[model samples]
Target: MASSRFSAALLLLVPALLAANRPLYAQTVTAGPDSSAVAANPVADSLRRTEKLFGWRVTRPKKAALLALVLPGAGQIYNRQYWKLPLVYGGLGATGYGLYHYQSRYKEYIKGRDLYLAANGRTPINQLPGAGDQVKKETSVDNIQRGIVFYRRNRDTFIAYNALLYGVTILDALVAAHLRDFDISDDLSLRLEPALLPTATTAPTAGLALSLHLK
Candidate 1:
């Protein structure tokens, strides 16, 4: 009798135990992330996965461009291309120096011309701002005016050069980043083969065919 009572109690306890664990089982099934849902949503998937540079998640080209825009040579450094730094800096430096030189000369000529005119033709051309014997040896108003124009033009040219070189460096960084994974292996090949060509005259002709293979 006692055994039968214990068996009845166990039977009741089994259903109660199952009822208590059912919600927990369902909770466990729903707790973790749903990979299929994440995969189905492209924006969520992209946000979940990212390419990183310098601990920041960003595409290579975009990162390189941002770095380059923030500071020159930073992009090349990020790309691990140390050699290009010299060329980039050299071009910018040369253009910057030329800009400084020409701008100074242009300003000097302008000042000299203004001073000559202000003195009401009494100031000797040689005694002008830039024509002070120790500086530029400009002797005539015509020569001073010509010098001003020449220096101004050269300054403007150097300004263009500086802008061009700066842009080139930024573009180089962007392109280099894009081509970082490009394949230039020996698998690329060109071949010449003989082929038959059909003509409108209903005759077949022999021809040499050139084929390019990329693998």
Candidate 2:
């Protein structure tokens, strides 16, 4: 009877041991909460904050060029390059001088040519007796023609150069304005010095040394 009771107790203890060691499965897991959705992304979050803080905008090159076209060196001034004002004014002055000189020479050529033609017409070519008068008239006509050609060439050259100068001025203004926005910070620096070196001699030897710093 004692053996029978012991066998029944063993059977009951076996089920309890299995229940204690077996893995348990819950019908539903209760997670407290996930907070990653509320956290900010580092790069995007910083960029958004920066955009909101500073009201930075880019300047248009075309607008700056147009401003320069309307007034010489105005765009350079707008770009904060005040030193270029003298150069702009000097270029315009030189071009203006070239135009004036060309105009004066052209007018002189025209007057000289008209006078030569009138003189030739007054004396008929057939009435010239000797080879000398014929040679003189031909020489005068050639001189007047040469003068007109030279004057016209000079005038055209001056006009072309003036146009090129104006175009260059506008281009310079645009480029200056475009470069004004460039970051020009110095982040690194270097220094060199002469140092005394330890030696066997009584006097120390001087040697060059370099030092560098970065930010």
Candidate 3:
């Protein structure tokens, strides 16, 4: 009886051990219509293939620069140079401020000249007064002319500076993009050495030699 009981227990334990050792194959049973549709779609497969072919795996420095030329700081952002964004914005801000101030002053000068002429309708020779009036009118005329000239100069300066800023920003973007993939390693080093030599002369003569190396 004990042997029969042992045999029965062994049979039960054998099934349990077999179940534990069996590989659990997880069959992905898709029950939805969407899964079937995706599996049957040829367009999606083609799109995936196209995406793999033309994916985001390369950077173009010239294209980045062109994008920056279209919009400042964009290329730097693309190149992941967050620190340079402020400099680019600051340059554009300065140029814009200069232009605005120049325009405002120019407009004020024009308005003042127009009002003065309207009030004093082209002063004739007889209407020309004593030294004080003469000086006052001459000063007004000179002030207006000076304001106009300075405004034009400032405006032109702003334009030139803005153009320079644009060019520099584009160039900087191109350079940054090119350097984005640069490799810097701990193995790089630069060394400089100097040697001194004494020459047999009447007095003590010395010669110096320098050596430089980069690795």
| Higher-TM-score candidate of 1 and 3 | 1
Pairs that collide in candidate 2 are none
In candidate 2, which residue ranges exceed 4 Å CA deviation? 1-58, 121-139, 189-215
Say which prediction, candidate 1 or candidate 3, comes out ahead on lDDT: 1
- The CA lDDT of each predicted structure is 0.69, 0.59, 0.58
Give a tens-digit lDDT track for model 3, residues 150-200: 887777767766776677777777676556544445565544434444557
Give candidate 2's total backbone clashes. 0
Candidate 3's displacement at residue 41, Å, is 44
- Per-residue lDDT tens digits for candidate 1, residues 8-110, read 5434633443343221111112221221212222233345334676687877767887788888899899889999899878867877898998898888888
Q: Order the candidate numbers by TM-score, best to worst.
A: 1, 3, 2
- The parts of candidate 3 lying over 4 Å away from their true place are 1-59, 118-139, 192-215
- How many residue pairs clash per model? 0, 0, 0
Every model: Cα RMSD to truth: 28.4, 35.6, 31.6
Q: What TM-score should be assigned to candidate 1? A: 0.68
Candidate 2, residue 136: lDDT: 39
Two-way TM-score contest, 2 vs 3, winner: 3
